[model samples]
Target: MNETLSLFGLATTPLELLSFVLSVVTVWLNIRQNHWAWLFAILSSGLYGGVFFDAKLYGDMGLQLVFITVSVWGWYQWLHGDDTHERLPVTQLTARGRAVAALAWLGAFAVLAWFLRSFTDTDVPYADGFLTAGSLVGQVLLSRKRLENWHVWIAVDVLYVGLYLHKGLLLTAVLYAMFVVMAAIGLRAWRRSMGQHGQASATMVLK
Candidate 1:
């Protein structure tokens, strides 16, 4: 299924086209806060792993494996990760939590960049490593229903567009561009969800 075809004047393989479609669906479900998103995330990540491997983007290829593993944990977290074992609600990270997340992203980027540069023949090790690290952080936050996950996604997706284009993966670049807009919509939607949850809690307390 790796046959190349001209999709909207851009050459892409069947594998990439399939991956793009599944990824879009995955993000759409994520915006809706549907648990089913994790399944699609797993599927798309598996497919994209192969796509990135062919492109020699070793960091991204490795990231797909990570994504597959995380998706399973994320799926369970969405279903039963709350303190009370309830369905998780959209929430923002505290200032300290945010600081820790930032540190984690930076540390992961440093280590991944060094590893990719030292061990892979990929041409854009730094960009690949940086975006890969940010994606991991974003995925973790998203798994926990954190509102700020969209912010990480927005930043990473924008950079990924350029990275994919440079690697001649035109279709994947378009996918990342679309992800930027979808991530913005997800941010707004999740914020509204958090506000509604807050109002509901306040009502219960007042009653």
Candidate 2:
């Protein structure tokens, strides 16, 4: 632990500090249902993408590229994808959607695990695969305004905290810890927004 702390240097560097600040803002914006959240997501992902590459977390590095693309898609979806001419509302996933998501997660886990084991010198292939798959699902769900995305993030972030710590990425471990708390807050806030939307819809129907 002492050695790890020395490596990250207590987050004193400008890039480290900036990444932390951007992550906080990204979580806040996500809670608020703000489209600008994608912008911050992109920025945070780009910074951490480089960090992951430097650490030789190639799966995570590739995931960041996917995140950048998803951020762009999410930005567009939040702005104009809804039929009501409003930002996409927070909503639960359909049963079919959940089933599909599960299948996707399984498939991704298999593929990523095999790829990591064969192509890289990673020590924890299964853990990397699990987190990578979960993160992909969470990101996709988030892009579509699915409230369960936060739940996925909460789970993934908890695992990520330990993973980063094991990998000697103390700063990233700290960030994942923050992510867990922020995901809980985001879940509550988004649920509240969804409830508000439900009430509004009911009122409109009665009118």
Candidate 3:
């Protein structure tokens, strides 16, 4: 089979096409709060691992491995992290929590950027490391049911779109572009969930 085909003047490969479809489904499921999203996340991350590797985006390749680990943890947490087997509910982080998460992302970017620059031949080390660190922080927030995760994803996806375009991964660039839109939708949906839950809890207290 041909590895690359011209799709509206972009490189579209079978593998990238598969990854794109799975990634879209995964995010849509995530917005709907379906644990099945984690399963698809695992699959998409595995495929993206190869996709990024072929593009010499080593940081992203490593990030995919981390994503798989996080997805498994997220799968279990979403299924059983509540009082029993109930699904996890979205909640906002405190100001301090947000600060701490931001600190962690900055710290990770510094470390990973140094490592990639010192040891790897990656061209866009800073951008790659920045996105990788942002993704790590976002995944951690997401697994813990934080509403701020979508914000992190929205930011990361924008950078990723540009980085992939620079690296000549047109399909992956398009994928991240879609991710940015979906992350915005997810932010709106999760905020709605949190608002409704808070109202319900208040009513229970009144009762």
The best candidate in terms of TM-score: 1
Residue-wise lDDT of candidate 1 within 87-162, one digit each (tens)? 9999999999999999999999999999999988989989999999999999999999999999999999999999
Candidate 2 deviant stretches above 4 angstroms:
1-14
RMSD values, in order shown? 0.6, 3.1, 1.4
Clashing residue pairs, backbone N/CA/C < 3 A, model 1: none
Judged by whole-model lDDT over C-alpha atoms, candidate 1 comes out at 0.97
Candidate 1: segments with Cα more than 4 A from true spot: none
Which lDDT tens digits does candidate 3 get at residues 105-167?
Answer: 999999999999999999989998999999999999999889999999999999888888888
- Backbone clashes under 3 angstroms, per model: 0, 0, 0
Worst 10 residues of 3 by lDDT: 1-10
Which candidate wins on lDDT? 1
Q: Candidate 2 on 15-58: residue-level lDDT in tens? A: 55566679889988988888899999999888877777666788
Sort by lDDT, top down from the best: 1, 3, 2
Model 3: how far is 111 from its true place, Å? 1.1
Question: What is the TM-score of each predicted model, taking all chains together?
Answer: 0.99, 0.91, 0.96
